[model samples]
Target: MTKKVLITGFTGQVGSQLADFLLDQTDYEVVGMMRWQEPMDNLYDLTGRINNKERVSVFYADLNDFSAIARMLEEVRPDFIYHLAAQSYPKTSFNIPIETLQTNIIGTANLLEGIRQLKEKNGFDPVVHVCSSSEVYGRAKPGEVLNEDTKFHGASPYSISKIGTDYLGQFYGEAYGIKTFVTRMGTHSGPKRSDVFFESTVAKQIALIEAGFQEPIIKVGNLSSVRTFQDARDAVRAYYLLSQESYKGNVPCGETFNIAGEDAYKLPEVIDLLLSFSSRHDIKVETDSERLRPIDADYQMFDNTKIKSFIDWEPEIPTSKMFKDLLDHWRDEIKKGKVPLNR
Candidate 1:
């Protein structure tokens, strides 16, 4: 029988790309879990296939609702569950801390709790991938290489929420014998990246300027932080490989890994790279205090050794190409008459 994999946050860049990867590369039947009103922009290519139920389908449910999730699990009983849904924006969390906490922390607990009940009743065991963020290690010391053992300093409410989500993943696995593994992925971005993100917003502004929809000035926030950038596609591949490793018993349940790119760059360099890809040469850069985070992660250098020892995975796409793709994605969106706001 063909195995099924459940992917929450099915409309986001990584989730949508994971659906594509599974459909194209593996025989797994893809069950995408999303809310009823979720936008299909990221999953446009799969809409027809999804509608036909051609090895892909969507399950309407929210992580906060344990009953709905339990119902879905009872019917689907997926071989793998990729828990990717969360209040993912770090800056937005400052304003909506309660919702972020409820959605990420409580929401994750709801999912695991439902699964624990299902396992107790039905003896269902599935490989679960809990998505965590590198933001858990906020404001690392200068030039420090973050590993799984690094202390978590919550720089923002979102980071704090993710810390709770991370602990729940380990707790569920260690306490209940769920085949779960956690990943702290560093700064992954690419095409279909939301404009709220730093790199994607710059690309969007540049595209708008090229389309004569905005002024030549690109507003930005603090650019002092250093980070390792990887394409979302590459990150999803690591996710898939790690899931198989967990299932094969090569990885211990509840163990954590830092999946990231090798090269690190300051924020300004990333901005410059995006600017270099733009069609307009006269675009100016301006600092926008409104966009700066209240508390920032100054350094995000992560070590990928722990993941590599168990799985054969590494970043494949170049960051330069990722910037180009992001710029082009917005350009294509503009051409589709989708005039985005100057965010």
Candidate 2:
């Protein structure tokens, strides 16, 4: 019997990559729930490569609508659910705080409620993997290495929303006997990363400069802040591994894990790494006030001992290698005229 897997936010960075990964697995049927308003460019290539159409399906559903989510859950009856949908941009969340709360918090509640109803009706409980952010750690102390045991001190509206979402997963799992696991993801970058993100924005600018479509100037913000970057592929693989554990009863429900990179890098170091791969030698970096976040953390790193002991998971892609892939992807997009050079 082929297991059915439903992934929300299927068109976003990590969700799209996970969909592609599961499509290659013959034993799973991938069902993607996406907002109708979002663009489908990310899944365009994956849609073409799918040889077994019956094994994959895309459904239109809004996370904010409980009825819509419940109907979809009943229809799919997925054996595994990966909830990755949300207003994920942290800076943007500041501008649309209300929308962020509704989507991240209320939206999560609807999904969990829908799953509970499905469990009662069908006597089937799917293993659910909820994607949380490392931002939930807020301002880490001077030399603190964050782990699952660390207390959450969400600094921004975005992190606060995630704090609620993360705990909701735990609440549903413990109170309702639902299989739920929350993953606190660090800054993961690679191909298909949104252009608005810091790393992707820099890579896109460099690609445009190299293609002679733009000037040799890279706009940046908060270069001194440090972050641990993981590859999106690696992060998604961790999601899959955790879900498998939950499904096989190897791991306890309501547990949380931190999926982060092995090494940390300052924002300036990341920019320098991208510049090293660029063919443009005249590129100049300039600090942009508009790009700066209202409240930024000086340093954020994770201790992955918990996840490492649970599964045979480790980040294989180095930061330099990941940056190279991102640059190449942006270059191809620019050369093909898929991405505009001007704002």
Clashes of each: 0, 0
Q: Where does candidate 2 stray beyond 4 Å?
A: 49-54, 341-343
True-structure lDDT of candidate 2: 0.88
Stretches of candidate 1 off by over 4 Å are none
Provide TM-scores for the models. Answer: 0.99, 0.97
In model 1, pairs of residues that clash are none
| C-alpha RMSD by candidate, in order | 0.8, 1.5
Worst 10-residue lDDT window, candidate 1: 275-284
lDDT for predicted candidate 1 compared with the true structure? 0.92
